[model samples]
Target: MAGTGPQVARSPLELLNNQAAAEPPLLVKHAGPVIFSVVGFIAAAGANWATRRPLLSGVHRYVLIVGGSMAAGIYVEKKRAEHLATRDAMFRHYIELHPEDFPPYERKQFKDLFQEWIPIR
Candidate 1:
């Protein structure tokens, strides 16, 4: 007797293509942090070399310090932005899936919590 089971007949070429698509590209998946790390290392080495020279006066040193601090602040702010965006996306998804959990009034309160200003007039 022949087997009478539902079969998914996929061509070999189709399966290979599917697998290739499933695996992320090497550079796209892994090169980001590596490239950033290399660039950061190079920048740090250059900064160290520049600061070691006596040609940099007090003002130059101070400016470099302040500039490096600001760059750190900017990087932190960018990470914060990315985090907030992800959080907001998750919150939105949750709200969409379980709308009963967040009523209009509660939604307004949540929005107010993140708002820059609350009008009190």
Candidate 2:
């Protein structure tokens, strides 16, 4: 004999864990920020030491500003790439699940538009 029971709803933690398992990890996610932060700090510290002044003074200020800007740009680009990848994956899955919703012409158009982000299969 076997017992039968209704399915139980997943808790928030379980859902999060499942989602994390399903999604592909982005290498740039943590690498970009950590690398940028370390580089910026080192540059600032070196500039301050060489000039014997605070980071806000002279060349040190410029170095810190440039490093910060570069870091921000890298982070933004990485996030954008991740977002685009996720969107493209969802779009492909949706197309597979509901082929009727997308006509051949429209599918081709979408594929062409995202050719850079998504590889044609």
**Index of the highest-lDDT prediction:** 2
**Candidate 1 structure quality by residue, lDDT tens digits, 29-114:** 54444455556555555676677943434555545555665566557657876997787667656666776655443223576677
Tens-digit lDDT track of model 2 for 1-110: 35454323233223222334434467644566656666766777687778788755676566665678567868777788799778767766766677676544322356
Which residues of candidate 2, in runs, are more than 4 Å off? Answer: 1-57, 106-121
The pairs that clash in candidate 2 are none
lDDT of 1: 0.55
Q: Backbone clashes per model, in order?
A: 0, 0
* Model 1 stretches with alpha carbons more than 4 Å out: 1-57, 106-121
lDDT of each: 0.55, 0.61
Question: What does each candidate score in C-alpha RMSD?
Answer: 18.5, 14.4
Worst 10 residues of 2 by lDDT: 9-18
TM-score to true structure, per model? 0.39, 0.40
